[model samples]
Target: MKQWPFYCEQECEQYNVSSIYAPYLFDTSLLFFKAVSTALDLYGGNMSFYDIVTNGTLIAQCSVGELTGATDIKCCRHQMFVYNKTPVMGRTHDCYYNIGKKEMAYIRQLRMIDHENVNKLVGFCMDGPVLLSLWRYCSRGCLIEILTNDNLNINIDGFFIYSLIKDTVEGLYAIHRSPIEIHGNLSSKNCLVDERWQVKLSDYGFPFLKAYEQPKSSSEQLWTAPELLREPEAHPTKASDIYSLSIVMADLVNKNLSFENSDYNGGADEIIYLLKSKTSRLIRPVLEPVIEDFNIGFTHLIKDMWAEEPEQRPKIDVVRKIVKEMNVGKSKNLMDHMYSLLEDYAASLEQDIQGRTKELVEEKKKADILLSRLLPKAIAEKLKSGQQIQPEHFDLVTIFFSDVVSFTVLASKCSALQVINLMNGLYTIFDSVIDEHDVYKVETIGDAYLCVSGLPERNGNMHVKEIALMSLELLKKIPDFRIDHLPNEKIRIRIGMHTGSCVAGVVGLTMPRYCLFGDTVNTASRMESNGKPSHIHMSADANKLLTEKVGGFVTKSRGEVIIKGKGVMETYWLLGKQGEALLNVDE
Candidate 1:
């Protein structure tokens, strides 16, 4: 491998600057050698040294390495400058070379003018590649970003706007009193905001270094005074800084970028050209909409600060006085105002929580009502409490089975929706009658409804009487129950009841049912199929409970009807209550 040396121009006469960079240069040569070895091995060691040197593609492809020795690449300065996503530390990398009395005085002046609103210049960097001025970084970004950010949900009322304006004025006031005597570039972009919403004016007081910098763009010149625009190289004056301050004030007032809503929609370059013209058009940002909320004199004061003649503009102290007057009755500081905002939020906190809790209670009540309809109230409570329900036995309870007569023929002639409407209309009348008695509704099949008067909550032998009275009322309502699809034709249902021992329990996990399992259920269903339409049929056990035990019910003998499941059963036709007239029931 060939040896190479590196040096900078300044130290060329003393030594090949390579002596200072010898360690790093040696590592570079070793890396090149490693790459050649990799390339030669890749090609089976068939290439000559001339062939290896000439193969640029092979060397480029073999640049990968896992070297152990490493050193940080940095400027020769002793202090390490750390970089972060939102760096609290930064470097300028352009401190002027001369560093004479004027430069020293200017830096000293900047260091002394460190007010809360003005950025603090920490120190200088001279030993690095370029000179640097270290400044305390403002992490909350600048006024330009704050005003232009649409996603930011800050409660920016008039009080917040006044605090920012007050801070900017105070920073400029501090600079005007210092030896530098002017903030050469005062744009919203340079006015940074801190985490606490305090504005700190940056990039101020570096006139000597600024002379060598690039020329300002037309967009940047939007805030420049007319006099400064005419004499481009003339040093920035206190009056020009005031003019720039007004442009920033316009941005805060309108909550936009500088001159973003200009009347001359021709953009920043066009606005600069129009202002530079000799015509008497006093070009300034429109300050109407936001200013109306403040004192009328506030608008006049800002216009005076940016007057055409430098002599007519108010000094920093005079501008500060008017700002104080405009904010006389307001909060003394932003912190106090923020505390007041928190107090207001806390005041309404209890009421908001109470209202939400009341709505939650109402919604829970509605859900419970719906759940009770799906299952018996006692069973629903047991299920909600995670109780295991075993099959329960009832000695004597009346089971009522009901279904529409000729329902298949009626539904076949109507549409599906119409059949649903017909079922709903007839069941609604049955449900209202059932509500008058003490009974629990079981599951409803296609045209069949199952009900019981004693198991979930038993009511002694009164279950037979309750079921008997409910069935009579249900048959009475069928006369007025008209089908919407078949208007002229009347609807009818056959109801049957039996009283005997049965087992009942909740059945499944998904759509669990309060199901009954016994021969009593089968006998009641058989009684319905054997009975005539518009009539209530009862088995021997139910009739004995109603007439002998409960009394007041009138029943006629059904007489050894051929029940499908039970061979032959003597059922009875329940006519009406003893004191009431007999129902016009079909035989």
Candidate 2:
């Protein structure tokens, strides 16, 4: 490697400059190297060096093993100068002295030009074998990494992809328009994505540095223009940069390496060989059929950019114009485009949540219907609200029990389905009558039906009136109900009523039942069992309450009937209500 001489001719004339300048320069270099080495050694290879002159600093000395993505590139932090203000990232490489000089020469030329999509050159450090070139740091990393990373949650829609292409074209056009008329080497790997996902062009205008760099693999050669690949001595021109741009655009769209879907299956080496061959057919990256959805204009633009002949390719400014037209009425920039997309996504998410909520409400309604049929509305509501239920006592209540006459005989005469139909039809009529009164149907066990009023929700003396009217209505409906299976057979129900205090509560957990307890319920059951079919039998308490308290019903006494398990008790046969019939009674 060549080193610049520290002493001039006039300084040599005035003093023993060789001895003084040589040792001083050599010692200064050695001392600087020793300081960096000590920092690295003390920290176990984690160290940073600050350049006092420019206020540029390297945060930590990155090792070859720590390098990600690329082998030759070491990403480090740097600042241009104290006056330059903002810090930036630097890509460092150990290159031959001649290559470093060549790159520095080109960089000096680029310092005057500026563009938004171009990575701004901060400064450079030529320390020993290390040649570091500083450029603005793009936190989001390179285009290739963004394209290939599966973990990155990027929305790569048409607008987003086109925005990147437009930015890339703008950068290229700026370079073409400047003194640095060409980016000899342009590729997806050289294009970077900033924090805002804006694509900025890098690794340009340093042909000498690129010359001594390791030969790219055949895969990487996919971005090289065919003319350059064919003619090794040809330098990269504006036309060649456009070709590379097309390859990068293809990678962005496909999210794959360039020419990944080419029909040529023999790998990158074979494709390169074919591309360089004079007689071989031209091969290009396969643009997916889906690309047509972006617009045919974009498709045609790419085709023209990478035309086989260098002269046939479009100019960077022409490409920029077309991209601008493509984006004219659209979002002004990438951030604006992303904001619009996010808003659309939020709207879609809200719609999905609303639809799901509506479905949930409908399912809850179905569950409520099933629960209401199992228990009273108040008890069901309490259970739904996660309230604990305890046994409740009613001071006075009317319990009613009823059963079909000769139900067992009728069931034996009919098929299982016919028996179900018979019961359903009979109960349908009874249910209609039950709905008219303020009573809760407790349960029905086979042929027996049980109901009560003023327990779960109290109605004072109205229980007697509600139960009397309910039982009378049930008896009236039963006489009119005919069994569907036995059309000629008349249906009859014997109903019994009792008025007394009782305890009611919900029981069990799996399939709960609201049950009434105490002698009142038993007495009511016995009254129905001991009475004749089609008759409304009432205990003395219920008869007294109905006649004296309610005063709407007429009754005849059935005195001193021996009740099961309760010795003899006075009972009465409820004949009929006021202005109603008392027909076919055994008086």
Q: Each candidate: what lDDT?
A: 0.79, 0.77
In the order shown, what is each candidate's alpha-carbon RMSD? 14.6, 16.9
Residues 244-298 of candidate 2: C-alpha lDDT, one tens digit per residue: 9998878767768888877776899998988888555558887773443475577
- List clash counts for every candidate, in order: 0, 0
Error of 1 at 101 (Å): 10
Off by over 4 Å in 1: 1-112, 119-160, 189-197, 203-237, 264-280, 308-312, 327-331, 341-399, 408-425, 442-447, 452-465, 482-488, 497-531, 538-587
TM-score, predicted candidate 2 vs. hidden true structure: 0.60
lDDT of 2: 0.77
Evaluated at residue 360, the lDDT of candidate 1 is 92
